[model samples]
Target chain A: MYQFTIKPLFGTEEWELGSTGVNIAFTNSALWMMITTIVVIAFVQMGTKQQMIPGRWQVAVESLTSFIDNLVQSSIGAQGRKYIPYVFTLFIFILFGNLLGLLPLGVLGVHPFTFTSHFTVTGVLAVISFSIVLLVGFWKHGFKFFTLFVPHGTPIFMAPLIAVVEFISFMVRPFSLALRLFVAMMAGHILLEVLASFVVSGGLAGLGFGAIVSLPSMLLMIVICALELLVAGIQAYVFALLTALYINDAENLH
Target chain B: MPQISQLAETFSSQIVWLLVFFAITYFIVGRGMVPRVMDTMDRRSKQIADDISAAHAAREQADKEEEAWRARENENRARAQALISEAKAEAAAKSEKKIAAAQKRLDKKLEEADERIAASRNDALEEIETVATDATQDIVARLAGIKVAKPAAKSAVKESLANG
Candidate 1:
């Protein structure tokens, strides 16, 4: 639970914004974000060698780029090339944020923070993606973009009802997108924290009790940690995949 | 939890920094690094395509050259065959003319030999007739113990030769 807390890195808990009603602080979350940013830039910049024969790092960078390239191509067809940078940024950013949270730096007395576990962060990302979808939709089709809510072959009489349902589902996309990643990251961390407590408490009780409770809990914890790593990558893929799908809709309108 | 309780204080900072860092990452990784990689890939593919087309052109050129060489060889072979047949016919004609000339010369020589043999046979027959006349006259003179006249003896031999 303490690991989930966002504390100030220096000075007071927060700073006043020159008589404005707003307050801000440089928390561990921001520090980790900056770290993630640096890591991402260095990894990508180093990997981009532009050589005819790529080295290992360059291969890794190319593999990831091609993965997203294929994803966008499959989902959005040719026109999707324009949106690759945005979608790629979203994917790598969220992926690094998720993985950096799971780093085993606790032995070094630095508790890793998962910024992606928060609704605000995920919500902002989702909003950004959704805004792009809306912009592309409106920019391309103008008022006809509203037709997206109606099914392709709906009856005239049933169109209104279908449109209402479709509109609601369409509007839920961003919320679902944001909530899925937030809940997944938060829940896995919570489970691991609980099992860790059991390990500590059961170990303190006795060797026999430790075998019965702590051993199993520790085993389960390890399994869950492995599962969390998979989840981190899957969630990142899902985020990018869904963003491409949404962009596909905006571009193709179907 | 500070997540909910400290939301007001932290949310602004998180959003501000997230936007800041995200923009930086987007500019550096997405805009800058990615295009260079894509351009390299594009250039590589273009080079491969050019190489393939050049290879294809070379193969076609080789095929054409082989075909032309074969055609020239066949034409040369046909010309050589014609030359061989012409030389054979010319040799046959030359040999036939030489044989005919040799046969004509041999026939002329054989005719002259036949004329010569006939003349010699005539001369030999005249000499034998004269000797027979002289022998008949001498035999009559010696048996009869009388001198026979020359003209008489010659007339007697002629009469006897005619009678026989």
Candidate 2:
């Protein structure tokens, strides 16, 4: 019997990943992300055409394109248009990764909820999103984006203290962006997988006397699946929205 | 900060797959896919705008044609009204010519009748003068019991005048 858990296959390993002291171990999260990127590239490329009006594939791409356009406009204003493509890509990639993870192949090959494993996929995605935020900020504002930490109308007497707070706030940008995405994915996956494991246990337990336990587990799996879909959409939206805001802040030279 | 260290000590195993996944997405979509999609969308939007402009031009041309048709219709109607007025004047002129010709003919006939009446009146006056003279002479001769001859009277008046 296979179990679902958030742990790496090589729990105790060390590796040198081209001067970045990263352990080299493959996980399902890595596989899913690879799939997501390939999907995005192919989806965009194949959808491209020379027609005035969009066909089905192009229309599908436009749907996301317009959604991101509106999202950026409402959240960050017109300056957000420049960031739309990147944000849309981020949103779709995260969404698909989360959704596809819910499928049969997402967390397979490894046992569920094992003690030796930890969810590292969320961390890597977090790093990427954070890196983008940092890079985009720097590219747009140079060093002016640092002023984001210092809220307007602060007292001159507390300048040093305010500066320290600003530094801390600036430093936390990556962490915050990364953590928000990582937490949602990690929590949703864990909760759903745990409930699913219980469903199996309950099914085994039910002979006719344990009907009540199995019934609740079955109902719970359905609920979790529904919630998983919502979480996936929300996480993707949050990631894209935050990235756009970061771009907006930088663009405004705030 | 405490939670971080605790997590670091507890489970550092799942970090490797995260890096691999991030790397793949960043390279594929960020570098390759996004540009293609954006380029296509931009091109499509421009093409749609051009199509919209063309449609607008076509609509404007149709409107202009409709306006021209309306103008021509109005012109034709005006020409018809003017022609109708000219025809009415021509009809009045024709009727006026006939009426004037008939009036002139009637006046000429009336003038001829008046001339004939005047001639008859003069003839009657001459006859009446001759009759009155004969009656007067007859009456005088009867009253005097003798007739005076006009030749003798005239000769007597002339003899008197010569002797004087």
What tens digits encode model 1's per-residue C-alpha lDDT throughout A8-125? 7863444756777455567788889889888888888866788887898988888888888889999999989988898888899999999999998998999989999988888889
Please, what are the lDDT tens digits per residue for candidate 2 over residues A159-238?
Answer: 77998987787667766776766666666666766776776787787666346666787788788778878887887888
Note the Cα lDDT for every prediction shown: 0.88, 0.64
Could you tell me every candidate's TM-score relative to the true structure? 0.77, 0.68
**iRMS, all models:** 1.3, 5.5
lDDT of 2 at A64: 76
By summed lDDT, which 10 consecutive residues of candidate 2 chain B come out lowest?
A: B1-10
Kindly give the stretch of ten consecutive residues in candidate 2 chain A with the minimal lDDT sum: A110-119
Clashes of each: 0, 8
Q: Tell me the spans in candidate 1 whose CA falls farther than 4 Å from its real position.
A: A11-14, A198-202, A209-223, B73-164
For model 2 the TM-score comes to 0.68
Predicted model with the maximum DockQ:
1
Q: What is the C-alpha lDDT profile of model 1 across B77-150, one tens digit per residue?
A: 99999999999999999999999899999999999999999988878766766787677667887898777777
All DockQ scores: 0.46, 0.17
